[model samples]
Target: MSALSTFANRDELIVGAFAQDLSEVAERGRATLDEEVAATAHPYSITPSSLSHS
Candidate 1:
């Protein structure tokens, strides 16, 4: 009985840790996407041809 309880607790702990890590990664990904969107929200006055002489 004690062994089963210990195993259950260990499994729960591992699942919790995995969930936390995944949540952190998701949050970081969302933040990165938001930053990219914000950076591209403004339009440049210059044309693509102006940027390149060729």
Candidate 2:
């Protein structure tokens, strides 16, 4: 039995809490990426960009 399964049959609750935490982390990561993309001028910066060959 998993650690969560031992918690008085609250496995679903435990999983849901973890899922919510992960969702918040992902949202923050996306926001930070947006800020970085907006602040830099380097053509090949860490942010993603469409391909170009000129």
On TM-score, the candidate that comes out on top is 1
Residue 39 Cα positional deviation in candidate 1, in Å, after optimal superposition: 0.7
Best by lDDT: 1
**After TM-score superposition, what is the CA distance of residue 24 in candidate 1 from its true location, in Å?**
0.3
Q: Model 1's lDDT to the true fold?
A: 0.90
Tens-digit per-residue lDDT, 1-54, candidate 1: 699999999999999999999999999999999999868865765757669977
Candidate 2 similarity to native, TM-score: 0.59
For all predicted structures, in order, the TM-scores are 0.73, 0.59
Lowest lDDT 10-residue stretch of candidate 1? 41-50
- Mind sharing the TM-score for model 1? 0.73
Give the runs in model 2 whose Cα sits over 4 Å from its true position.
1-9, 42-54
RMSD of each candidate relative to the true structure: 6.0, 5.5
Tens-digit per-residue lDDT, 1-54, candidate 2? 988667857877888999999999999999999898778757665533354544
